[model samples]
Target: MAGVRISRAAGALLGAAGMVVPLAVVTAAPAQAASCTTSTGPYQTRVERFLGRPVDGKQSAADCKATQKFQAQHGITPTIGYAGELTWRTMNTMLAQRAAGKTPNAAGKCPTNKGRIACVDLTRQLSWIQDGKKLTYGPVPVRTGRDGAETRTGLKKVYWRDIDHVSSLYNVSMPYSQFFDGGQAFHSVTKSMWNPPGSAGCVNMRVADAKAYWSLLRNGDDVFVYGRKPGT
Candidate 1:
């Protein structure tokens, strides 16, 4: 019979049961091939557990501190609360790289060799646009959300274009929408600039940035948004 697969948080319950019942510990899955220099920590451990790794005999306080430090050093502040969407997105990328068997250099940082993708650094609250070898867009500061209106973090393909911007539901036409989600979009906001932790979930940009961003794409452009930061 196969042993029950248990999550790290569930292991305690299973361990207690082992005292009264015959419970053979399940072996850990092989560590995914990773060349990252930073050691693992509580948050990473949680991520690993989420990825189906065992926490049985692996706990690293130093690694946790190091990981937290690494994040701070890289521009993400240490938030003691639950892992935010941005952190989770970064973690997912790190996990993917590790699973790919890539090795890190002596400095312990993940290679900056990830070609052309949007990576938002939450601490700096900036969006970096890359295309293969060049960083194309910005560290341009913009608003995100604070009232529980989180920016979506995932891959979304551009479907259509709404040049006259407004809540089409409201019959107000103003700017543009590449139309990633129903109403959520990237558009120009003449009202607010340099204000972060704002926006009702739409990525608001200045007219110039908005226009530039709009011009950079067409129908079917793949856009990956991560971190709840504003963008152009």
Candidate 2:
């Protein structure tokens, strides 16, 4: 009887050992591949909408590439090559405003003399050069100031033209600067002005647009800024 009891105890112990062995072996095995889900995040949906995609919340490879491209143009960092929260927020806001037709128009008459003038529509974030009633240049995109640092609206004259000017206050390179209202000027910027946190009262433009403005207008040219920048 004693021998039978000992045999039974030993069998039970062996069964427990068997279970532990497999568990340990499974734990020691190599990890599985990363299962990147197909389901899209909320930010990804916003990005897709901004990009004119179907917005099905599918995180395809192409979607990621497009997001990366936008981030690169706007000088957004990390360049993760993916549509994350920050990328989505910036792009969505800009596109929403544009879709709502909040930008300014170029139909109105130039406020200054008929010789040559630059008309800036703050609401539309557009600027153009006109020869009185005739439109010569553009409705080019521009970046203006934030809430407290609003770009002054009214008639202004380009007092200085600095092709390679550097801002003394911010120490930033302001290429093709056409200073009109005090320190406020039309200059080139690498950062994306479409999103929030705009310039410091100056009119920020693309490098090409700023160069074009520099060539079209001279010092003392009239710069009429009208309308109000949206969200400011």
Candidate 3:
């Protein structure tokens, strides 16, 4: 499948444009391709079940394509249009959690003091900008740091804004970055990054949502991050 193309120098320049601080390179591995087959297996069965199909454990071209669609929608990586072991496991976890429930925590942890703030509930994997109780935007899907590198919680402020920020550490594009905590920003990442493998420490958003955030938020706006990621 096709991936974003950019030279090292170009990436560095993008990082520099964002005034990124130098840091150790993140050693996370890129997404890998998995083998596909038409044979039946537990993994295939789970995928079919999640898709509301007969639990026959059989793979088909149509099934593979449907899996790819699911992967893309959820930001799964190596979306090879097939239901591999990793794909099945990720889907199973998400299904087990039933994470799409609309309600956030009843605690209302978001700060009302600030005129407009970004509220990120890691537990729901959702975020929104609000003016006190009034909703301005969101509750959009987000991907936070995985097990090894959990995104820091608590209150923060939008100290920086970078429309074309690149990770100096990972040499990866981090578009529409709004830096709150040090080295941990809210930015747009590839949809594939949301699947089996996850972010290093940043809160990942879709490109359109990130752009919307950029437009809604201003420098020094309050940002509240609370709750735990589901299925961690």
Q: Give the TM-score of candidate 2.
A: 0.62
Task: List the RMSD of every prediction in angstroms.
Answer: 20.6, 26.5, 7.5
User: Which runs in model 3 stand beyond 4 Å of their true positions?
Assistant: 1-49, 55-107
Q: Pick out the ten consecutive residues of candidate 2 with the lowest summed lDDT.
A: 19-28
Is candidate 2 or 3 superior in TM-score?
A: 3
Worst 10 residues of 3 by lDDT: 18-27
Model 2, stretches more than 4 Å misplaced?
Answer: 1-47, 56-113
Per-residue C-alpha lDDT of model 3 across residues 127-190, encoded as one tens digit per residue: 8888877777866777777766767799888867778766544566677878777667788865
Cα shift from native, residue 88, model 2 (Å): 7.8
Q: lDDT tens string, model 2, 1-232?
A: 0011123443354344321100000112223322333445568777887887778777886776676667666655455445666666566556644653422333463464546889877776677787766667766778787667778898878866667765433444667867676557788876556645466577888788989998999977888888777667
**Could you tell me the TM-score of candidate 3?**
0.66
Q: Judged by lDDT, which candidate is best? A: 3
What would the per-residue lDDT of candidate 1 be over residues 111-224, giving only the tens digit for each residue? 235544443333234444555545566545444433455556666555556566444233434365544443345666664333333555555666777677677766665556
Give per-model TM-scores.
0.44, 0.62, 0.66
Best by TM-score: 3
User: Model 2 clash pairs?
Assistant: 103-124, 104-124
